[model samples]
Target: MIVTELRFENYRNLKNNTIVPAENVNVIYGENAQGKTNLIEAIWLFCGGHSFRGSKENEMIAFDNKYFRLGMNFFSGGREQSADIAFGQNRKQIWINGVERSSSSYLTEVFSAVVFSPEHLNLIKRGPNIRRRFIDAAICQHRIRYASLLSKYQQIINQRNALLKDIRKHSELKDTLAIWDDSLITVGAMIMKERYDYLKMLREPAKTYHHGISAEKETLDIEYQSTTKTDENDDFGTLTGKLRAAFDASQREDFYTGYTSVGPHRDDLDFKINGISVRRFGSQGQQRSTVLSLKLSEAELLYQKNEERPVILLDDVLSELDNSRQDFLLNKVEAYQVFVTCCEESNKVQLKNGKVFYIENGVVK
Candidate 1:
């Protein structure tokens, strides 16, 4: 996927602006708080229409401004497409090709963007939720059905929890608990299957990239840490049945805890380097290298599945790497569209064919 044009108005500190980026690599440099990362975020948000920085809608509006708007024209499916977004304090609207659409229709067969930021360097050491989110966000882009199932599963869990809370005061509500359990088990099983399939496809590439970055000294291993053991040869029916049984076994405990106790919501991704848990055993460099490998692996996996290299947004990531590692990263993504944010022109990683833009107080020059 390639973005042919991008423009923003009243977004963050940036004024009405347009960015013309080279298809290969675009390097953006500025001093601290000059809106370098904000520019990167605009591209990511417009491409996928989701916030990678986890900012809310109103927070993205410029100070003293009424609203924010972004326009993105991209090339996908051997043709061009566009998305326009407008957001205010309490409302947001999205349009695809001038046709009003909801944000729910995104990432099905639409645009894909892979991002790497400094905060992700702690993926291995952070709580399990971060790692699970990493897998969910990446997989959801490639398979829209997985996203639907995830949403339904979350809803089922919420309903089940609410029922549990009511059951404490009125024991009569306990009889209908099986209805939610069945739905949760079915959807949760599919979610687990998809996550397992994705990680299974991702493990080899992540290890290869990890070995390249670690100089063959570290081996990356990934696995699913679910609430219950998964069967290898079971079909969907059998898997659902097994999960349902597990839920039934945990029902009393869940009722006591006032929530659904066993499902993918509690699942995690287990990472190890050379048979040792990276969370406790890996050094700082090792953790960063592992996260980098996984992210690059995500880009490669998307390309393999979609037949289009995703637009990569690097948010002030190179500053944390050495010269060799920086060069290696640039070399790895040279063939795809990339946008890198940095603090200085001298600190930029030189590329064979890349455009450089300067930013000052949110204006691109």
Candidate 2:
């Protein structure tokens, strides 16, 4: 997918702007706090239906404005499409191809984007929630059904936790607990199976990409750490059995802690190099390379599954890598349309064919 043009109004620092990105590599450069990152954020929001910076729709409006708008034109699978989104304190709407639509439906037809920022290292060093989010976000775009399943699973988990918190006092809540448990097991088991399958598909590509980027000096391994005994080959029945046993074993602890602990919600992804845990032992460079590999792997995975490439968003990450690593990244992304943000003009690396837009204050000059 390629974004041909983007227009933003009262969004972040951009009061009103329109940009036509290069088909191959488009670079936006300026000093810190300029509107470079904001431009990319708008494109990402339109593609994924969420802000990469974790900002809310209302907060994304210009400081004093009460409303914001973002629109983009792109081509996917050889077809042209456009998406427009407007948000305010009390209302929000999305339009695709001149027709009103839900953001979820808009996302399915508009575009897909994969972003890499310096902060992505947190996926490896942080808690399970971050890693889970990484997986879910990628999977949600590729498999729409996964999003519905995840939403259902999260709701069931929340309800079950509430019951657990009160079960001990009521004693009569056991029956209620059973009801949520059944739903949890059903949805949780499916979630776990999908997660395990995604990890399995991600492992080989991530390892291969990491090895190539690292010059084969280090071996990369990805392991899915779940509470259940799930493998790449496990069926739903096996997963259900494992989850059932886990719930039974954790009943006492759950009642005491007022939360259910053993399920996909608590799962994590582990990264290792030469049999050593990267999160605990890898150096900063190693960690960055691991993240780079993981992201590139995601690009390849999306292409493999959908038969089309996803747009690449690089947020102030070029300056974070050495010349060799930067070249590797630049070379690998040549096949897809990329939007990059940099703090200095010098940080804007050379590209074969791309646009270099200068961003200042809140304007693109």
Candidate 3:
């Protein structure tokens, strides 16, 4: 998806203004905390997801302002369209082409983007939750229904955990535990299936991108470390049966822990390079390349499924890479519109062709 024009008002530290960017590789440069990433974030919000920086609505409003407003004009579906967002009164509202939408989730189908920042390195350095969230977010972009399924699965897990804790207090309510077990297996199995399939599709592309970035000296491998022990060959029915048995086997442990410990919620992704665990064995450069590969793979999958190139947002990532790696990243994304944030003009000199925006004290010059 190409954004031809983007406008922001009373948003974060940005002055009320708009920018028309080049269709390829727009570089946003400024001093630290001068709203370079803030500009990238304003565009990312249109993707119908929470801020990648994890900011709340009130935090996004400019100082002393009651609300924030953002607008975008873009090219998608063989035509030009527009979308607007306004946040105030403890609520966020969305409108597409002048028609109001009840929720921002509807914009997921209209705009697509893949974002990379220094913090994303946590995908490998952090715990399983980070990797789990990365996979789930990727799946939700194309399979909108998966979002609801995930929500339902979390709710079931929460209820089951609470019931497990209660059963400890009164053993008589133990039999009622079977009710949540049945529902958990039913919903949890589907969650595992979706995660399995999405990882299967993601593995090959990620490896290919990693191979290129690593100069073909390394091999990348991605595997779903399911708590159920299900594999790619397992059918949905088989997944449910295995998950049911797993829950039954883990009952003693679950009861002792006061939580449902065996299901998709406990699953994770394992990344390996050259037969070594990237998390524990890989160098800093290797870790960065692996994350970059996964992100590019995410972008490729979005295009393959949606038939539209997603906007690429790079937040102060180029300065952290070597010259060769930087060139590889820029070349790989040349076919789509990109917005990169950096604190130095030298990073802006890397792109062969692109428009540059300089910002100081929240104003783009």
Using lDDT as the measure, which candidate wins? 3
TM accuracy, model 1: 0.82
Per-residue lDDT of model 3, residues 1-365, tens digit only: 88999999999999999899999988888999899999989999998999999999899999899999999999999999999999997999999988999999889879888899889999999999999999998898768799999999999889988988998889999999888888888888888888878888998988889888776878899978888877867888999899988999999999999988878889888899998999999888889889989998999998898899999998977775777777776665668898988887764336787888999999998
248-333: candidate 2 lDDT, tens digit per residue? 89999999999988888888888999889999999888898898788988988998988888898888777656666666666555
TM-score of 3: 0.90
In model 1, state the lDDT of residue 290: 79
The order by descending lDDT is 3, 2, 1
Q: Write the per-residue lDDT of candidate 1 for residues 188-295, one digit (tens) a residue.
A: 888887887888889999999888776677899986777866654467887788788778888889889998777789888778899888888877767777788888
Give the residue spans of candidate 3 off by over 4 A. 88-93, 100-102, 166-179, 347-349
Candidate 1, residue 174: the lDDT equals 84
Regions of candidate 2 where Cα sits further than 4 Å from its true position: 63-69, 86-93, 99-104, 158-167, 170-183, 347-349
CA lDDT of each candidate? 0.81, 0.82, 0.88
RMSD to native for every prediction?
3.5, 3.1, 2.5
Sort by TM-score, best first.
3, 2, 1
Q: Which TM-score value belongs to model 2?
A: 0.85
What local lDDT score does residue 262 receive in model 1, on the 0 to 100 scale?
A: 75
